[model samples]
Target: MYRYLDSRPAGNSSISLLARAIGKIAQTEGDHTTAIPALTLHRRNAPTKPLHCIYGLGLGVVVQGEKQVMLGDAVIDYGPGQSMVTTIDLPVVTHVARASFHEPFLGLVLTLDSRHVVQMASEMELPQPSRGGVYRPISIEALDGPLVEALARLVGLLDEPALLPRLAPLIQQEITIRLLAGPHGSQLQHLVASGSPSQQIAKAVAWLKQNFTRTLHVDELAARAHMSPSTFRQHFRNITGISPLQFQKQLRLQEARQLMLNQDLDAGNAGGQVGYQSASQFNREYSRLFGTPPQRDVRRMRAN
Candidate 1:
């Protein structure tokens, strides 16, 4: 589905420049965003094992190499000169599909502001989402001229500290405007719509994030989202690619991992903190999700 476009020579140049800029600024492999707010730069020297992380609403530009993001059973792949847009918070297993010491993986990610998107959509008179279509929170497209140039210009600002305060916002606006007018605008339109089903599901997701340590009931979550249980289930799966219960489980497991790694909590304490009443049940579920028992996994993570 992701065919490489041959016609856009300028866009390719922009992508190359983006990769070069990121590689120059990022001395090592990690998020290097100290230079610009909400602008994250990443570099990897080689391919990696699948890693789980929570991806927020943002636009990711793959300046070099390819990556695969797995959400439930769906695998979304993107490569050089490609841009990925995700409209909602998602816990995904991501792998760097292509990279090497010579040509390391380089990427730039921009955190999108929902407020800016909503305001821009209103100003541009974008249409509301149609009622019948299923929603996908993430979409990928080939980079276009305006978006590529805006991103390149934004990264270029790192060298010009004085102009950044004044010009960065303008460039960011241009990038958002390009997205609003592009093929993925409708998806974003629904994401930021206040009372739309997508937003309602987002509200439910927010509640789940806040109350992950507590008991969750489908009916209660549906009521919080202002939808019937069946409708809520349908839209929740459609948008997030997972059930609400699974969503809460991911949050719980991730938090438990953090607690074990950061606070030096034992496996039992970590499990209890994340609402697991039975230690055996917690160990089983944690092994199922992370591919190891909690203590062993924590040991491996700490060693790395």
Candidate 2:
């Protein structure tokens, strides 16, 4: 899509072919985690519905098909030649746009460790920001040969069963280094470094995640991140594009949905487990965020 991705042409090994290979691996092994424990590959057929936000750091590469991930007001798309990189955990609505019986969507997800990202940044002669950089929740760009080749080798290891246990983790680390040197690595560096807003807010985010069920106090969280309440509030909004309360609310609801869908809990009970005092309030918030009530959403997901 973007000028043949630097003369390599993706060759005749089209993304569709890659998708088929990944799909077959999934079929035989049951999940990508089994074949390559270091990376998580989601091989699925395309459809219109969106998936709930998953809070994790990763590089999302599309080997076949297309997808768009929505973060706040921004929508970022990735397909055959592109990928999505998330340096910090944020809520997002993602949808697949292309697929069929003839072609399924193949994608690989690599978990990012912020410490390693910062370490890579420190090793490089990175520029110091003269001013605040661009404000965007997601950034996209073309995938080049280095990224493609690393991914290919990582994927190929699935078939070379005997080599996986020893090799998978190493490749995954290489992929992380590759991304650190790639286009968007600078922003990722800022995210995990001490004193950066991204780092401060991420610290607050981790706290919320670990203590999601507890009642939140803005002042306490701000103190925990070593910032004044006002400064923490402003930075939290800037980095995540959402207020602290809103972030916690999404976390609570998303966790509730997972419980209902995976643990077979009823809607009201799930809400209660996540610090919701009233089921009616939970249903109202769930409907607003998901555009459907909990029971209906879970039922439709199950039928699918």
Candidate 3:
């Protein structure tokens, strides 16, 4: 039996059991929506094809199995007992690297509410950040006792529908509080804090997201964030780990991937729809980023 890292008397369960339940839940209800207000479970068999362009605002916690995600040039890998937090909209390639039918890759995704984070920061007397060193837009770390317990409570609520109505929100708040108190809390704090560089970058991000297909003028984006080009570029790179152009490329490619997956659009049309004018340039870049020519990639992805 695995040890219960959490010291709390109420929230305790074997990891194997929790993993089984989570896997069942994921298999029973596909995708993130099934988790409803608080958490979602994702399970898949071993050697499954990677899921492309998963977009969600949430915390990813692994109960069983392992995963690796690619964000631009950055790659993050996590296994059981670990978690990753996403503070901004990101385009990523997610791999379910380990699983079997009997023991599938099991994980829980807890959606983080910005409002709840802000309120927690206001009430809990957030610890003074010692250093101003930057943090990742997407961060990964080992889970703590408090976080595990909070997650356990959140999962337990899934079985008790009546309690879930009343308790999920409370437990969700508790989980966000725990995250805010954890190692990477400072980033979330800075994200919600007024005048923080991350907040400014978030504004730029919002603009890019809305106007992804539109040609961007850095001058206009800088003006939108109330900062000059030089400062905006520097801080935006710092917060997002990529330059503005790189971020936009990711958004465009992610959108293109969706169009190919959901619609019967051909590669050239999908590229054009995502603002890629030259078919050759689009095909080359698409291959470079997604590791295949558009048609082959889409077909392979669909086969998965």
Candidate 4:
């Protein structure tokens, strides 16, 4: 179990209020998506197996309990009063690390609009982010009083359905402004600033995701991002914590798994659908990543 210590006096009240609100709504052990299209609340009563998925641009806040997320070799653990911001889409493994019947894991994720971020950055006249340093796509930091208050108010709006249409956008904007002005300012700026390394890599990532089923040529991808193959490879690995080939493999395997589970496709068909030409090689890599052969893994997932 994780013990939470709130050192900020002003934030304690808001955090408590937010926790209560989340607990009331997330009464069961599952994910709850509210009327706010971009917001989702999560609840878990016990530790869970690590699940793989793609995390897009969003803000995640843990009002109670603890969770862990793994990006390639990087592992991040965060608890109450801590928030994580992901500026680019990345494949990650995540699980609830600590929770119990008495104190279930409670958290919320708010999808961020990159276009709005660009508009706000322009209006704020924030300087361009530094280009020389390493900037990971994801960051974790302690939530400040203003951000927590804004989030609490956003959740509080759920009580008034009529007011949500009128007020949610304003609070969401406030949350975005706070994030841009907080410790994550530079990272967010890097994501939006034109021709920045992070932005360039983001473009390459977007291309890879859209064309994952096709053959990938490193030089072609690099050229599309206006980077040399070597520089693009380095920046991609630095930001996403995985080489291009590894990233592509993850995408293929994840998609194959979904096809097998949802479409009732056989292992061979799913593998071929995801760009694998050799059945033996596909089964080998599928077992390596998912810890089971395709059919068996699908069965287990369906059973759960």
Which RMSD does model 1 reach against the true structure? 2.6
lDDT of 3 by residue, 151-192 (tens): 766776777877777778888888888888887688687778
What's the candidate order when arranged by decreasing lDDT? 4, 1, 3, 2
Runs of candidate 1 with Cα error greater than 4 angstroms are: 1-10
Model 2 C-alpha lDDT per residue in residues 1-304, reported as the tens digit of each score: 1211221224435454555656766653213674554477776654557876864777777776777776665566667767667766788788888865466677777777766676767787666532367533455656767777777777878888899888877877787777767776666666755676767787888888888889999999998888899999998887776888998899999999999999999999999999999999999999999999999999988887
Candidate number of the best lDDT: 4
Which stretches of model 2 miss by more than 4 angstroms?
A: 1-21, 27-32, 122-131, 135-137
Query: TM-scores across all candidates?
Result: 0.92, 0.86, 0.84, 0.93
- What is the Å distance of residue 139 in model 1 from its true position? 0.3
Error of 3 at 95 (Å): 1.9
Best by TM-score: 4
Ranking according to TM-score, highest score first: 4, 1, 2, 3
| Clash pairs for candidate 2 | none
Q: Compared with the true structure, what per-residue lDDT tens digits does model 1 show for residues 169-191? A: 99999999999888778788888
Pairing residues by index, what is the TM-score of model 2? 0.86
| Candidate 4 regions with alpha-carbon error over 4 angstroms | 1-10
